[model samples]
Target: MATRYTADEIVERLRSEIKDRRPLFMPNCGMGLSGKLQEKGGSDLICVSPTSWWRLRGQGSLAAFLPFSDINELVFEMAREITATVDEVPLISLSGPHNPLLGHREHLKRLWEAGISGINPFISKIYDESFCEQISNIDMGWENEVEIVKVANEMNMFSFAYAFNPEEAEILTEAGADVIASHCGATRGGLKGAKTGLSLEEAAELSQEIFDAAKKVNEDVILFAHGGPIEGPKEVEYIFQHTNAHGFTGGSAAERIPIEESIYNVTKEYKNVPME
Candidate 1:
């Protein structure tokens, strides 16, 4: 019922919110990254992943749903309760509605009004039986799947993804995908978004292709990569230095520890070994 808060404004105030940029710790539970952003020192912008968006939609739970189309008090509630306490920013990634046709505008609107950060809509597909790969399984090889792009452009939301094929890069750009995500590798980590396995070199090569393709179409778009077992220090370094991504995410890495300890483990030296 009230006006929404601005995501940009929140980003601007992030440093002040957390006092110091501590580890932007975002832990994912079954209920959509379960809003557990904590910090010891330094400021941080720990955000939540909208894994429940899909589940709620599938099960039809409005209460569990994020009012993404508009900003509601709940948005501020989440921001004030979580971010205010931890000194972090609340980013609601509307992941499942990656397909333009499936995106819930009303939900997105509410998020903005609540001062929740950007809407991260995406279109992801597994390498399936029809894997000849002439065109993408989802986009059908269109340069701008007019349907999805129109909504993102009209909303001015961030159109990010876990894995976007080179073929659909331009299509996504036109579709109003503000931030392109570099995610998903060969395996599924413990959770939904985490795609397991990819040596730093492999991740680097693939990420470069993504950046290069986007450049050919729209170089101005923000580049983001996420697929990783970001447990090792070298792995973190590799992700930051090699890929086009400005950030990296590791569900298993963060998921392995309890909250009380994870806050510290995030900075500690751990390794994610390949599955035997």
Candidate 2:
């Protein structure tokens, strides 16, 4: 039988563990599991992909990517490694394959069996039906605001924000998203004139809009802003206060610094929201 974890149980475990040991804020640190993340952040580091979105999540420094056939096996191995190094277990979030709905629901079932804290689905332009198809059983994915509300409230998970869309913020707030995130600093920007890299300023400004919109809908909805070029602790604080996101998650912001040093500085200012 599939191991079913209530949202509350997941939340409680995550909260308790993090409260004991600070949660590792993993981001687009590298291709496939990064040793840097493990070396500094420890086992709590989540490994995610798409090089665009769902960047902050982690699932330990994977020796090999999470293969659907034996995802649980991978998780067990990673858990062992993390525990060995960190000396304790912390919740890890995996950035799943492009679409959770891609394979049969069995994939999700296996993932659940692996005992992951969360899985973030990648893919742009997701609709309700297509979105529902991806996260049939899983709680979160790359969903729109309408879908975010449905997933957050019904499934009891969190989700991403529509890229720079203020309107979508309203939808996410209603969905019960504990933290609102975005991929403003991902790798795949269309490369316009000068092939400009992803901009955290754009992300920050947009996050402010999302924050204002969500507040208009409901003030309690906490925001979790992300992207690259955050620069320093002051920038993190600026974005957090400006965008109204209670937390911020983006590695490139401090890619230059030692990973642990960066996190110590960043999390000292902000925190994270639970996502799947």
Candidate 3:
């Protein structure tokens, strides 16, 4: 089982990494084996989410955004497998706060008890303006997501938030999020990844804008870049060069793409071997 970490401990660990001038690498994992391998590969942190579960099932991460299943419940189920395999690296679970059946506080407590050290809002900040407005009209909106971060902060649990623009970043920072990841959109490059979104330059500009907004609220809050054009080492390096982002958060770029390429290549290599 993984060693549970206090929120402060997790923050200190990340701060120490930043102090060393090392870029934090947080990868989202969907399975026990993937989490174990990521830990062994020196991941700064491992994140589990319903999107990750879908990705591992050969579906796009967006599948989690659909109403086919309860995302909060999926996080718990994935955490069970991940916590059982990841022994040291801290785990962050991405969850939706709009589950009417599960109270946010109760859900957070359940995550803490399951050995997760932190929480991030998933299926929250990724929608379009019209969809967001509609969700807000129904009382299931961005504020609900912010409330989850607020609750996590008050509980002394690490709170990481994803923001698409400056306004959202400011709100989450004010809610006491320990880390603000500037989301560009769905990641691009993998088989199931987004084919069109922000360019590298656009992503960097947006990241800087969001980071600035978050810093205005709490300068101490750590910052990261995620999704869209920020897919791999080269793009990450570009982000680091162009903006003040402290690290990166990878969903598809971390697990699905690598797994797809590795398995496909190896199978092809085997098939290419000369037969007797």
Query: After superposition, which runs of candidate 1 have C-alpha atoms over 4 Å from their true positions?
Result: 1-46, 50-90, 98-103, 113-115, 126-149, 186-197, 231-233, 255-276
- Per-residue lDDT tens digits for candidate 3, residues 167-253, read 989999999899999988899987898865689999999999999999999988999999998888999999999999999999999
Ranking by TM-score: 3, 1, 2
What Cα-based lDDT does every candidate model obtain? 0.44, 0.44, 0.89
Structural similarity to truth (TM-score) of each candidate: 0.57, 0.52, 0.97
> How does residue 241 of candidate 3 score in lDDT?
99
Q: Which ten residues in a row have the lowest lDDT in candidate 2?
A: 187-196
Task: Report the C-alpha displacement of residue 58, candidate 2, in angstroms.
Answer: 18
Better model by TM-score: candidate 1 vs candidate 2: 1
Q: How accurate is candidate 3 locally (lDDT)?
A: 0.89
What digit string (tens of lDDT, one per residue) describes model 2 on residues 1-276? 112344455445445544574432444333323533444554323433322121223222222232423333344345343333332222333334433353424434454444433444332333345755665446444453245235434644433333346676676666655445654543221111012254656767877877788778766554556554564567677776556555555544424234445566688666654455
